[model samples]
Target: MTGWTAEDMPSLTDRTVVVTGANSGLGLEGSEAFARKGATVVMACRSVERGESAAAEIRGAVPDATLDVRECDLGDLANVEAFADGLHEDYDAVDVLCNNAGVMAIPRSETADGFETQFGVNHLGHFALTGHLLDLLRAADGESRIVTQSSGAHEMGEIDFDDLQHERSYGKWDAYGQSKLANLLFAYELQRRLGNHGWDNVISVTCHPGYADTDLQFKGPREMGSTLRTAFMGIANAVFAQSAEQGALPMLYAATADDVIGGEYVGPGGLFDMRGAPEFQQSNEASRDEATAERLWAVSTDLTGVEYDFESA
Candidate 1:
């Protein structure tokens, strides 16, 4: 997979792809790339209006692109369930599900379900969404892929089981790191469970966009009303980060590449994994701990109340 780009993606005609946070940044770029390859993309955005605008923008460029815009607010489990219900009503099977939506180092806040915002939306939300749709994914004619977006911040993470929600104390970056780490744990655990259930046609993979220049960096600072932090992040993005399209390559590769198997992590292969072409990479050891993954999975299922029906496949 040396120097792999979106142009290297195989045809996705007749495939269905679901991309969360599809309105902007890596999600937008990935959605456009999938659409260009003839995949029927389901833009799962928090805002239906913005999702429609993004769909319109893609249609302007790729006239034949088939797109559907749907509302999926990850912070709210009810909204995620509704979104999945709508998809189940419409499509018999989904070929790819990109767990791309996430919040960065934002101020400590609670989601609608009273969980920490970053962990709630980033990891738990995707976990619940995947469970809700796992059956449909298995119904696909061929192998169906679930590509989840993680981050390099995961290296600094340690799952605080005593306080998974960070209710006792909250450090913004630490919370973000924990959530990102949960992403890897969830992805690896899901892959293992699918294998144990003999569902080889379904696979789960994780990826990270190394220092991608996207609005995600600014949102946290903007939310905290810290102009100085926002400006610093902007300068850093300008100097060190790659474009969103370039950063999205790893996710696209994980989702569509023929050689990609379950449980693999994809990321940029440059200095410190900050930028470059997509390649197979390794996550931190904590992310690979089977015991941790299994415990996290149990906690997630209990928290979200969405259980995977492995036998349904």
Candidate 2:
């Protein structure tokens, strides 16, 4: 994917896709790109109003776009379950699932479900949702793909087994890093298990938008436009990031490329994978550790109470 372009992407004519956090940024742009390829897109977000607005934006761009807006608050597992159930009822099967919605570098806060906000929303919620849709994915009969959005921050993260929640102590950056790392691990392990279970028909992969200028890094009111915050964001955006449309390229490639393999990762092809053309990328050494992958999967099942037959995941 070193020099991949959307024009080179195969048509997604019959694909039905769902993208989390589709109200804006990379997710929104990704949905737009997919719709342009003739796929039916679903924008899964926390706000129906915001999602519908984004849908309107996409439809304005692609007059014949087929799109749907569904409310999904990832911080709450109850909502995830409902979202999955709603999806199952609304569509016979889904072709692609982009686990892209995420909270980044946020201060300590608890989700409605009482889990740490970043970990819950970015990792566990996706974990549960993936499990919830595993059967439908397999039923798609080799036409399905799952893309988990990760980040370069994963390189700095180590899964703290003693405290997955950072219950006793919490730092915003580290928690966010840990969550992103878990995303990679989850994708890798899912691919491996699917292979072991003889379900090679399903594909699982991970990707990250090289430093994209998105609202992912700013959420709270106080940090919205502070001078220092603005300066830092500007520096990062100018020096290392691409536009959100560019940021979503690796994921778009992973989702639509004909040759993308399960368990592989894709990212920007540039300095530190921060910006440039889309291409295959690698995560930190910890991301591929088989032992850690196994334990993390078990821990995820325990925490989310969403168990899949290990032989069929």
Q: Against the true structure, whose lDDT is highest?
A: 1
lDDT of each: 0.96, 0.87
Q: What's the TM for model 1?
A: 0.99
lDDT of 1 by residue, 124-224 (tens): 99999999999889999999999999999999888999999999989999999999999999999999999999999999999999999999999999999
Candidate 1 minimal-lDDT segment of 10 residues: 304-313
Please provide TM-scores, in order, for all candidate models, with all chains considered together. 0.99, 0.95
What is the per-residue lDDT of model 2 for residues 1-313, given as tens digits with 9 covering 90 to 100?
5577777778888788989999999999999999999999989999999999999999999999999999899998999999999988978778899999999877788888788898999999999999998877776735699999999999888899898899998988899889999999999999988887888778899999978988775563244446677567767777766789889899999998888899989999887788888888778899999899889999989988999774553
Q: So what's the TM-score on candidate 2?
A: 0.95
